[model samples]
Target: MVFSCLLFGASALAAPAPWYLWRSKLDGQVFCAQTPPGVGWQRVGGPYRDARCENTGVPGK
Candidate 1:
C-alpha cells in the first residue's frame, strides 16, 4: 500500500503545471509562466495545460 501511494504521488507530481500568458505593462511584450511574473505584468491568457499555451478545453477560442 505504501509503495502504491508513493507511485501515485510521483505521477501526480509529473503532471504539467498550469501556465498563463502575461503581458508587460511597460513594453507590451507577452510571456508565459506558471505564476504571475511580478510587478508591471498583467495576465492576458490563461490556465494552459501545456508550455506552448495550447490545450484549453474549448477547441479553438
Candidate 2:
C-alpha cells in the first residue's frame, strides 16, 4: 500500500502543465502564455505594440 501511494504521487508530479502562446502582432514574435489551471491568460513579454494574444499548444523555439 505504501509503494502504491508513492507511485501515484510520482505520477502526479510527472504531469506537465498545459501551456499556450501569445503572439505579437507588430513584431510577429510569440511569447509563453500559460493559463495556469484556473487562472486567465497572461503575457510573458514585457510589452509590445497592438499585441494580439492566442492560445497555442507548442512553445516558441
Candidate 3:
C-alpha cells in the first residue's frame, strides 16, 4: 500500500508540457503561442510588403 501511494504521488508530480510560440512571415505577426498539453494558434501581424516573415520577432529568413 505504501509503495502504491508513492507511485501515485510520483505520477501526480510528472513534468509539465512545453510551451511554444509561432510568428508570422507576411508582416511582423506573432501568434499561435501555447504551452504543453495545450495547443493553439494565433495571428500576430498582417501581411508585410516583403515576401518573408521578417520582423516577426524571429531571426532573418
lDDT for 37 in candidate 1 is 84
Residue-wise C-alpha lDDT for candidate 2, range 1-61, written one tens digit per residue: 9999999998876634445555555565655534432233344543222223343343232
Q: Can you write out model 1's per-residue Cα lDDT over 1-61, one digit (the tens) per residue?
A: 9999999998876645688889999999997788888899999988786666776532223
Top candidate when judged by lDDT against the true structure: 1
Clashing pairs in 2: none
- List the lowest-lDDT window of 10 residues for candidate 2: 46-55
How close is every model to the real structure, measured as TM-score?
0.64, 0.26, 0.28
Best candidate (score: TM-score)? 1
Of 1 and 2, the candidate ranking higher by TM-score = 1
Minimum summed lDDT over a 10-residue window in model 1 is located at: 52-61
Better of 2 and 3 by lDDT: 2
Ranking by TM-score: 1, 3, 2
lDDT-best of 1 and 3: 1
Task: Compose the digit string of candidate 3's lDDT tens values, residues 1-61.
Answer: 9999999999887753322444544444454333222233344443332224333332222
TM-score (C-alpha, index-matched) for candidate 3: 0.28
Each candidate: RMSD: 4.7, 10.1, 11.7
lDDT for each candidate structure: 0.78, 0.47, 0.43
